[model samples]
Target: MVLELHVWGPAFSLPSIDPKCLAAIAYFSQAVPKDAWVLVASSDPSVSPTNELPALKNGPTWVSQFRNIVDYLRQYSDGAWDLDSNLNALETADNTAFSSFLESRAQPLIDLSLYVSSQNYWQCTSPAYGDLLQWPNQWLLPPRIHSAAKARTAHLGLSALDLDAMEDQRKRDHSAAVAAGKIPANFIQRPRDTVSKLLGRTSHQSQFRLEALTGELFEPLEAMLGGKDYLVTADRPTSLDCLATGYLALALVPELTFPWLRDAMKSKAHSLTAYTQRMRHKCYGTAAVKVADAYPSLSPSPSPSHLPWQTPERARLATVGYTLINSLADNTPILSSIRAQNRLRQAVESSKADLSDVEREALAKHATGMKKDVLVSVAAAVGGVVALLGYMVQTGFFSHEGEEEYEEEEEEYEEEPLEIEVGEAPDAFGVMGL
Candidate 1:
């Protein structure tokens, strides 16, 4: 079967600005059979199911969204490259929670960086759209996409804070330049430009939303990552790892014009940088060279740790706990209902002596049905907890007894680096003759 992925053309010397596009590339690189011919193409809104790029055509079927594309591929391949196959119930829950967190929190920052940031838009993003469109469309579409992106960032509260920060910094810099005799002291600063006024309307907001989001999301991600080879405790790369790798690889590029966003990403725990580099080497070979070329000054040197197919370390209990809590919170209604019912049952049992026969029967009938509900809920909860504990124990989360063996195997598995070549052009469509 022929599988084709449609995405935005690449800009800023990285892959697509859309994180999902990068994600689709990462997923297919590892998931599909090596011999399978999957074409990645650049597409406009007209061809997409939701008028968005990153749509996938699998044989005669069309699928949109990264998650849906993945699901379709899994089903088509009969569960080949199923990243969550080995995850126990708790780990699965943890994966789902973390994925949702990344989507809601980190993804917006990416959109802001690409489309909302003035420098990035003019220099990197708009030109990308221009390259894929014909004449008037080249002129017409970028602004619309930019406007939509800005609207999205505004909705998420990222655009205003960042724009204000940029405007404030620009004013400061201009003042400093004048004080140092860099420009004529008598010369007045230019009035606020259109972009500035557009983006800086809410300048009074005290905190930087992007910084807050970065801290809120990256702190836990960094802690969970630690020194592990992948995001989860799996022996091989998983879908979550693909997503994390794609988002980080694209975000951490030096050429991105959002100074605060770039600095914030760089300030993340060193392991994140390390993991991105490792995944880049493993999943994207020659493509890494192009991305590095975009930011020659900040390009990382090749490291021995870029070896592919090494076993991943088990996740920490702290990471597991965070995942569990987030997952449980996501299911708050079920848990809350269960708790309320339990309390009601306790009250009814304690006050049984004071109840009339009719009241007793009514309470007993309610209790009988609740017992089944409670049993099912309790069973599910207990099973999840027990599976998590079992996984923790199996991985030696609490001890180092078998760590030496894992280390030995890790050493033994190291070999000549395997090269998985991403498309030559940053935009896969260009390579596919789209």
Candidate 2:
């Protein structure tokens, strides 16, 4: 039977927005024969047993997550499709270690770029999700992903990168300025010049922190990759290479509103950038030409191209309802907690079964993210109910006992639009990438 790999759909002209999904794509592209399998960008994670994307299916059997999928694929064909087959025992162990290291170090950085960065998320990442998902999913997935990203990167102390956090800071600064009663200078501004300067400092600090983070991930990888096209051997890519390519390609490829990740990769580690392009072509073919086009400076010469893989399955009508149901289940307080608890229990139980340490950590992270999501959803639901009640009361639609109801004419007021400067300053990463 033909294998079916169900994953998140294309975004930013890449096969998948998710790194693990991209890793799976790369693995399949290199190892499995073209006719043996087909990719289904179903985008509905609910189909998987784990209710996660990047699920590989071989008839009745299924596997989720990147490492698990790789392990499963290798075992499926008597090592025929094993990319790491050439590696010795020690090399295989290193492969696993480096893969985990790449994930643990690289994930938060990716999160910071794609989700924590306000402008990037709104303008690029969220819109990509919108394109990949159907109606209700478009409404639901991005914010949860953003929340998860924030939680993952919370240790980095980079709340300044968040749009909501920044907006709140601006509001607090305005309040502080007004409270100080200093009509002193730059008063009639969205934020005073002084406040802007403060924001600029915070922005710089965040940039520096992000640079440090990028170095922590890329530097070691670059050293490990010293003069080698692939991570292990120059002959061909192994599982470790697939994992590395998945993470590095996303860092180098996507043209985000915040180009810090891409810029940092190009400037800080040229070899890694070139390695990513090589892997990209090997895995994605012409579909990844945009990756080269995005970084034309790095790739000045014309690059070879080949026929792209078949287009993935589009999100269908059923996907909309499926996402809605899952979203509701995920948001309901007690129900969500129970689900998360159950998931964690399952992860624990499956520790011995087949779930690798990285995949297990991911599942645990999902549980943590679910708790936060439930809290947010509860607050939103409560707030919406209160707002509806207030609207009804004001409109005299819902009368209160022992209270007079009256109608009043709505007054018109001239108000300029609230223009937000979503764009960062031109010299954004000036002090960083050293």
Q: Backbone collision count in every prediction?
A: 0, 0
- lDDT (tens digit, per residue) of candidate 1 on 264-359: 766966777777777766765545333222222333553322112111123356644554463465358666566556655665675324578788
User: C-alpha displacement of 428 in model 1, angstroms?
Assistant: 99
**Over 4 Å off, model 2:** 172-200, 289-319, 351-434
Candidate 1 least-lDDT 10 residues: 304-313
- Superposition TM-score, candidate 1 onto the true structure: 0.57
Report lDDT (CA) for all predictions: 0.65, 0.78
Return the TM-score for each candidate structure: 0.57, 0.73
How do the residues 183-237 of candidate 2 rate in per-residue lDDT, one tens digit apiece?
5446665643232244476578776787788898888888989998888787788
Clash pairs for candidate 2: none
